[model samples]
Target chain A: MADFEIRDLRASVEGKEILKGVTLAINKGEVHAVMGPNGSGKSTLSHTLMGHPGYTVDGGEVIFKGQNVLTLEPDERARLGMFLALQYPVVVPGISMTNFLRTALNAKRGYDGKDKTKQVSPKEFRSLLKGELEVLHMDDSFLPRYINDGFSGGEKKRAEILQMAILKPEIAILDETDSGLDIDSIKFVADAVNRMRGPELGVLIITHYTRVLQFIKPDFVHVLVDGKFVLSGGPEVADRLEKTGYSEWAEADEPAVLKPEEVA
Target chain B: MATVPKVDVGTDYKEKYGFFVPEDYVFKAKRGLNPDIVNEISWMKKEPEWMTKMRLRSLEIFRKKPMPTWGADLSVIDFENIFYYLKASNKQSTSWEDLPPDIKKTYDRLGVPEAERKFLAGVSAQYESEVVYHSLQKELTAKGVIFTDTDSALRDHPDLFKEYFGTVIPPADNKFSALNTAVWSGGSFIYVPKGVRVEIPLQAYFRINAENMGQFERTLIICDEGSFVHYIEGCTAPIYTTDSLHSAVVEIIVKKDARCRYTTIQNWSTNVFNLVTKRAMAYADATMEWVDGNLGSQITMKYPSVYLMEPGAKGDVLSVAFAGKGQHQDAGGKMIHVAPNTTSTITSKSISKAGGRTSYRVHIKMYPDAKNSKSFVKCDALLLDDESRSDTYPYNDVDAENVTLGHEATVSKVSDEQLFYLMSRGITRSEAETMIVNGFIEPFTKELPLEYAVELNRLIQLEMEGSVG
Candidate 1:
């Protein structure tokens, strides 16, 4: 029961369904990748799992550990050990990355009131931040800069990884984390995720290309097409889809993916 | 990460500023207002012939004008009972050593001297009705930079003071402005010579150290062609049993090809009613920026305004308002584009927590002949608790068809998911709320000077305490 389970879940954004009945489970101690072509609900699935306000759950349930996540708010779910590395992480002006991380950390601690712990001292927090920066190869100035403001493509992804490292959420869903990164940046972020993957950590990496998976080496790969997972297999599936593209899935989901020719 | 349990002060935080008002100070006039007191204030200032006449005229206007029916309620304002002027010190001090000890203590408590020693190029400390300490670097003064108290400017550089004072905002501009014009006291006067740029910012710290006192500061800034200057003004008043009034009038003139930025942060005690009139004008190719923050006051009504009077000129105003219980922060900006190719942007962020009220009232107008003008106004509000109230009222008047105008506003409550996310990370509920609130006002805080921004965030955190169950 110490795992994330989605059972035949369906969701939609703005009244338009983007996630069909689907089932997937990721237990603690594994890295799973959901790869698909554009408009295949790959990103939507990730957002729905995180309970993005724009996405509404129409059916099924998402159980994080034993609690039904659908009953919880996004921040509540996050406090429940879920994190999302957004495809386009919001650029919040005026909020420094360091300050944002500190607030998030304190919020998580508030729930675990059982431990009578003192707030992290500024000195210790700064040093811990410095250590995280060193691991991510980020500059010291990045913390003072506004969160993701004026950040380049690679820097934004690196920032997301740094947040994941700091908060250390139990279940991390990285949505298109490798979309705009160069090969080197992709390698760095993938390595960061790999280093974070352990028996105590579970990850759901959402991406369109198989490039990032090459380094992260997911334990499982799933093909999401037309709002539904058409196939699920081991890491080899990413290679097959990368070579053939979405043509086969496009033909198979003609009814589910496309509308019938309208009367003119 | 560890969470610090919130300390329950049981309303003791409100009492922290209880002694902010000094009791021993003698009252020059009663709490209520009257024409006799206005005349007495004029008599005390020992003004020039024309200045006294202007004050009498302003007083007459104030008497005849009706209280504003819009915005915050003024029924609580007993004009006849409030003193027009109360001088804490008889003379202005050119150096810190000459200032009265208590006044100096006030500045020391507020860290004005430390701030000056660290970053400020010049400092003006106004306590009660006069400047107790004023000084500027000789290098800046030698560069033709003029910085002094407004009254001092009127006495020494009358020509410069007369040219810009009341030009941007006239005495009859509004009732509060008229009241301020009649009883105006200590405020900063700055002039950046043509083609001269001030490297470090000039700061003015205004404090109301006496009880039942009304502070009417008049500030004037003139930046000549090709010149640049950044001025910051901050105000703090001790909490008092009876309400105090702070009505200030600020006028700025940014000449052609020059730039000026005026920043104000006010943290008045919950009992003070702050009514202020601040405006600026920009000439051809000039720029004017107002970065204002209003965090504390029982009732605050301030709108930093800009008039883009020449083509190629620009105006930008960014403001943030936080209203806690029993407080009403009605603040925003006004942008008037009167020339072709002019542009203006106003971004306002407000937070209303614990049954407090915040309103964003903005106005953007482009003249009929002003072609190619553009104005964008965005107001965002975050409601932490259900009892709090927030409103956005923006007016966009575009007479010129060629102008592009846009206004967007959104009122959002703290996202539960965002809160839960922070909690799972080991942060407390209060800390989570603080993060969301900070993020909501990041646009405004980032625009403030570093130290000022830090203080603003800390104050917000303090106000958000006990907000979570």
Candidate 2:
């Protein structure tokens, strides 16, 4: 069985269908890239998979580690080794990043049936946070600031990657993580992800552009259009799409077929 | 990752601190207020004749002044049903063992003595109508610092007490001030000598442990030239079916080049009406700060004020109010700039939940001669539900030309995106809400002492539980 699977998932926002019978599966040690155009329901799928309250799962199931996660709350799904890196992170003023990260880490640990009676000591937490920050190339100053309150665009994205590094979920969903980031930042974030990659982690990189794929190569690339995956291939498919553009798949009514030569 | 204990957020908070001892008073005055009751209180205290006359004059003012019709509902406050004077103990002692057992137990439960021994430079514990226990560290006393109850200050340092008492805030300043002056009994009086700095804070605990009690405590502090002091006070009352009243008048004087900081955390049970008048006067190059937090009370109407009287004087007021079910917190600050080049800042934060209401009432006055002065006021209110309400009423009277004044107010409801962001990171919904609320008041809580800040955060978290379905 796949480590995580979304079977015929249908979701809606504000009574309008966004994810229409989307099926996807991810294994334990593979990176799956979901490339789509604007308004192609990429974020909706990410949000629905994580059980965001605003996104209603009208139909289908999100099975994570053999448990249906659609019925769970966002936080519950997160503890089940599912993580969604938000496209537009919200700013929580007055809460330091260190405090929030620690709380989140502890919550995940407790949910994993660890010894809930013992919290990570301050010294241990600080050292761990320091290591994560170094991996993400974030300054120690970010730890004391209110969570993303006045952070720059690149800083917010880096902070999200930093959180992902600290939490180390089994299946990570990076929703447009490369958006609004400069080339250097994209490289930095991709390097951090590459370092954390191993058999224990599966990555789902959602993006509108193929620019990020130049840094973080994917094992499989799926073309998502109108809430459905129309074509599936490998790294060469992204190179082809980069030249052909999403307009071909975006405007097509039926699912497009991937020519054999485009697959790698 | 300790198993988060199931905090009893639904339980009555007053129950923990509200367990009352049997009524054993050395003197108990009759319910209701009149000139005779005021004079009788003065007579019982054996106060100087002038003080007795002042009490009579204040009683007249209290009667003449009408109930405030603008703020929280005052119709529920039945003046005729309140016991204005009930002295639980006769003399104030320096030792906890010397205090009456019942009163001592009340303080022990409230952790007054423990706090004093831990960090406070001095402590004064007031029960009902009088200070039951008072103590000052010998080091502070030997430094010419006077920290005692107001009643004792009047008898021991009469000349100094008479010089500054009622000078910053007079009897007729407001109706509650007049009422407090007429019936005031136990409160702190601190005098810091010139150039002397009190390193640690002097704390006072006021606990009302009786039904139908009216606690009118008058506090005054004087920080002489180049001196510094910080005074903290905490108040709590027992749960009663009928309403209790807490009307206090606090006055402070910050002399030339001196600084004083006063902090108050009032959690007076849901059956109490807490109306207070607190003001301070800052002289040339002096600084005055008022950190006020109001967490409980059926209705609370308090607006701590500061008067920037001389050049280079500064005033800062950081206040936070949390109004839960059936509570109305009408609290804010006032800053008056009377001299040139003075500066003032007022930051107010409030939260209203469970059909409760919170209002920020601010007033900033810049006099004609107050040129080149600056004043900044910020008020932020958070509503937890649609039924909860928040309001901001600001009155800015600027008569000076070269002054720079700015006022900003915001009323916000918890945003769905913010909640989702926190929850997406594995924090529970209620925990996320509590974190957001704490972050909203971070500026105010950060200004508080470490222990108080932790307690304030805990109280806010307890209040946030079950706030969302």
Q: How good is model 2 by TM-score?
A: 0.87
**Model 1 per-residue lDDT tens digits across residues B201-300:** 7876432232113378898999999999999887432222223788999999999999999988877656778999999999999999999888877899
Per-residue CA lDDT of candidate 2, range B1-469, in tens? Answer: 1111222323552365242223252554478987767766776567887788888888889889999989998987778988787654422223534433433343334444454421111113233323442234566788999887788789999899889888888889888899888889878889999999999887764322221133788889999999999998873322222237889889999999999999998876677789999999999999999999998778899999989999999999999998888999999899999999999999999999999999999999999999999999999999999999999999999999899999998999999999988988888998899999999999988988898887677667656863211
**For model 2, what TM-score does chain A reach?**
0.92
Please identify model 2 stretches exceeding 4 Å from their true place: A111-116, A250-264, B1-25, B89-136, B205-214, B235-243, B466-469
Q: List ranges where model 1 is wrong by over 4 Å.
A: A1-93, A101-161, A167-190, A197-264, B1-27, B89-140, B206-214, B235-243, B398-401, B466-469
Model 1 is docked with a DockQ of 0.28
Candidate 2, CAPRI quality class derived from DockQ: medium
lDDT of 1: 0.76
lDDT at A151, model 1: 97
Fnat of each candidate? 0.45, 0.84
Clashes of each: 34, 1
TM-score of each: 0.69, 0.87
